[model samples]
Target: MIKVDPDFITFEGIFAMLLSIKSKTSCGPDNIPNVFLRRYAESLARFLVEIFRSSLSQGIVPKDWLIARVVPVFKKGDNAIVTNYRPISLTVSCCKLMEHIISNYILNFLDERNILSPFQHGFRKGLSTTTQLITSIHSFSAVIDKSGQTDVVFIDFSKAFDRISHSKLIFKLNLLGLPSTIVNWIKSYLHSRVQFVDINGSHSDFLPVNSGVPQGSVLGPLLS
Candidate 1:
């Protein structure tokens, strides 16, 4: 997750998050429509504040928030085959907003502590993929100028994010000296998730997801 530093979430923050939701977005499994949510943003924010605090102190998340709607989108190959599709999870919009708030806080915390190195490019501000590519080219060009020989190996980390263990993530968080409450909040967020795959308007039974971040959630990329 691209950790961010945000002060404690206030009523204003929650209101803003709720307002940011697009009115036409299809609701999650709970069927709480986005327009309805925005129409009562103030009241919803109040309730959400209570829910979040209760969750943090008790280290328990609402089952509704943990449930996801998984849709198999066809990418290539034969459309008739299940193997040709990729599963995408659509989580509750409210849960996503909460995750986004936490992401901001985590990022701010990391920035204050200088946890990320300056050379890091991916997901960082002021460093685009193009910028990094040009930097690498200049470095390699200089090397060719001096020795006339260059050897470079490019490694892909696409699947690495999906393969992370929760235990290791928790250990790393602990190593960073964050408060236990914050660490537990993260752990709770990562646990007991369930997703139901929808095919041709038919939804399969909810299946437990034991590993990896929930793609498309605000927390997913940052946590990754």
Candidate 2:
């Protein structure tokens, strides 16, 4: 698995993408399209790989990867209602392929002064930090409120790791305008190489586990 910085995936790139889309298209929070945001996030992750690949290929490993021991930490924080998990091994190769396509082709097209590269420098850094600050403040405010009126809920799904329906996922991919060839490749890849370890020490091997696919994967959240 190609480990990366969890912060990079969660806040940095995501916040930047949100701000960019909002500014360019005037899609405010109330008007933002969920599907569009999903695609944007996937694209942003791919762009990040390009920024790091030159260094990676030169034998300069990413420090985050070395420290984390996983591609990125996929967490369901206090606000999360559910969680999912997929083996890192199954999706890393596909994510790399997706990154290559975005960096070499999509990014190049954007750079031609026609397409817009979503990696708009200062915005990412600024928005990322702002998001962290806002989240921290909100959490603190919730705790300090004199009234115990704040409410929180968490939902956990059973067999979440093994519940994906490949056909449904493929349909969603088609809706997202991904080419059939790429979609097919993803389906085959997911179906052919996943191994799972259960809580009871039992092990199973199959196409990517259906239920608990990794939410952090570039494609997983999009498909979900």
Candidate 3:
């Protein structure tokens, strides 16, 4: 006689399905997986734009029209603890994705608006400052003589997460053509309840009703 747990059936079914799919004929780069990836990227971009709009609606515009200017204030020490600090750690792959989205937004914004001159001054200054900072700490040259006197600029958004509008995010998700099932999954995953234990061994349960996506989860970055 064999004993089987109900959980085994679910796990084995999923595993068998995945194995069958893998064993089938190879789908080239232009297959369903690639299509899904592109769709996800588009959805993520829409989500980010919604976040930016929400921030603006809440009167949380960029302070200096520069992203580098919005630096975290941290003490220069090993044991220094900054209260309420949530450091974002991104892999090189994630950084590249962010860069792509920001570059697209800048180009689109410039194309739509003829207000480049006014924005160029701060942008150039911010770029120079950023280049200097990057080069000063790293062993690299700060100045780049690319093209003929081309100016660089940077735009930073301040208090980005603090200003994220949950409702607007849902609207953007819908606008991006994400299925309701997926949207509901995201909302439930982000809004799940959690129990926390304090330093004094006191436990409290709380639900993040209006929080954006969690930053530190294994699948969080991929979903974002």
Best lDDT goes to which candidate?
1
| lDDT per residue as tens, model 3, 1-224 | 12112121233332233333322332221123433334455454444445443332332323211111011334365535753445332212222232333333333444456534532322332445566566544432323333334354556655454445666776765565544544443444334323222223343453233544333332333333
What is the TM-score ranking, best to worst?
Answer: 1, 3, 2
List candidate 1 segments past 4 Å from native. Answer: 1-7, 80-84, 125-152
- After superposing candidate 2, which stretches have Cα over 4 Å from the reference? 1-133, 136-149, 194-224
What lDDT tens digits, residue by residue, belong to model 1 across residues 67-124?
Answer: 8888777889999997687667789876887787667767777778999876667666
Q: Assess each prediction's global lDDT (C-alpha) against the native.
A: 0.77, 0.41, 0.36
TM-score of 1: 0.81
The model with the greater lDDT, 1 or 3, is 1
User: Lowest-scoring 10 consecutive residues by lDDT in candidate 2?
Assistant: 64-73
Per-prediction TM-score to the true structure, in the order listed: 0.81, 0.33, 0.34
RMSD of 2: 16.6
Cα displacement (angstroms), candidate 3, residue 204, comes to: 5.3
Q: Which 10 consecutive residues of model 3 have the lowest summed lDDT?
A: 63-72
* lDDT score of residue 14 within candidate 1: 88
